[model samples]
Target: MDQKLTRQAASRVPRPLAQALSVVEEAAQGTKLWCGVTAALACLGGRRGRRAGTAGLAAVAVAQLVSNGMCKPLADRPRPPKGWIPHDEVEDRPDSSSFPSGHTAAAVAFAAAAAPAWPLVGALCAVPAAVVAVERVQSGAHYPSDVAAGAVIGLGAAWFTRRSPRLLRRCTSRPSP
Candidate 1:
């Protein structure tokens, strides 16, 4: 299934779209795109930007940690086979497990985390985040399952970050067992 899907994507996607996806992929490497957005928010967004930026970054960090540090090391899956991807960039795919996509993870985490604090900014962020997810598969760096898992991890991280304070309050408020 992954092979056939990748083959169709490689053949069917337009050249301009492929190029655009490459740009998005490069910007997303190691969350550089997100850092730039967060910086802009913190600088020009006033108090609301600061809150959203902080929350977004925190969630991204957690998502990256869980996706890259823990999950990648445990899962032994690899990048798509070379013949499946008819792109030159296939050679650039990382030699690591592709069970989850760190880029997608960070993107979703940032968008999800920021949405509650700044709805407009979060909506804007979601566009690129969605692009990042597609780029992961279109680039042949990950299968669709990898992107899905990464998105799940990202959402989980965002949820945890958003809820941790309240959860802590609940835990602390409880009487000694």
Candidate 2:
């Protein structure tokens, strides 16, 4: 099954895309940048920024956890054909499912949630997201569709969480003085 899928992807994938994926694989492979960014966002958004400052951190955590734990595990989809090739995966072969790239999900979620206040920082998150998607493809950990789906879910989660406060306020009434 995995081999058949790999052949299908190979037959259709443009050389440019494959090359780009390779580049992403190299650029972000084993980099601890994501961890640092996660920490920074958590600290900055903790109690220093605003009443809703932690939204980014919260969104990221929720997005990644769901993507990694619930969604991926439930999907239980197989990896790409070259999954055992040993060149693509940056970390351990996750026992969990692989429908959505957790790294991509977290990156996009953080970007979307934090963009309101920190445009530059949020924008930077896109780099890692793109890299993770590309790396997933190059490493044979996921198909493009999987990465795309994960990205959509992650981004959607962030957007919803970011606006949740305002939406909740509008729905609820304050006590009359």
TM-score of each: 0.95, 0.66
Question: Local error of candidate 1 at 100, Å?
Answer: 0.6
Model 2 lDDT on a 0 to 1 scale: 0.64
**Clashing pairs for predicted structure model 2, backbone only:** 72-97, 88-139
Q: List the residue pairs that clash in candidate 1.
A: none
The models' CA-based lDDT, in order, is 0.91, 0.64
Query: Relative to the unseen true structure, what is the Cα RMSD of model 2?
Result: 5.7
> lDDT of model 2 at residue 94?
52
Q: Give candidate 2's TM-score.
A: 0.66
lDDT tens string, model 2, 11-99? 55566776676565454433344455656665775543332335566677778777876898788887665534434342434545668
Compared with the true structure, what per-residue lDDT tens digits does model 1 show for residues 56-159? 99999999999999999999798888888877877888899998899999999999999999999999999999998888888788998899999999999999
Lowest summed lDDT across 10 adjacent residues in model 1 is found at 4-13
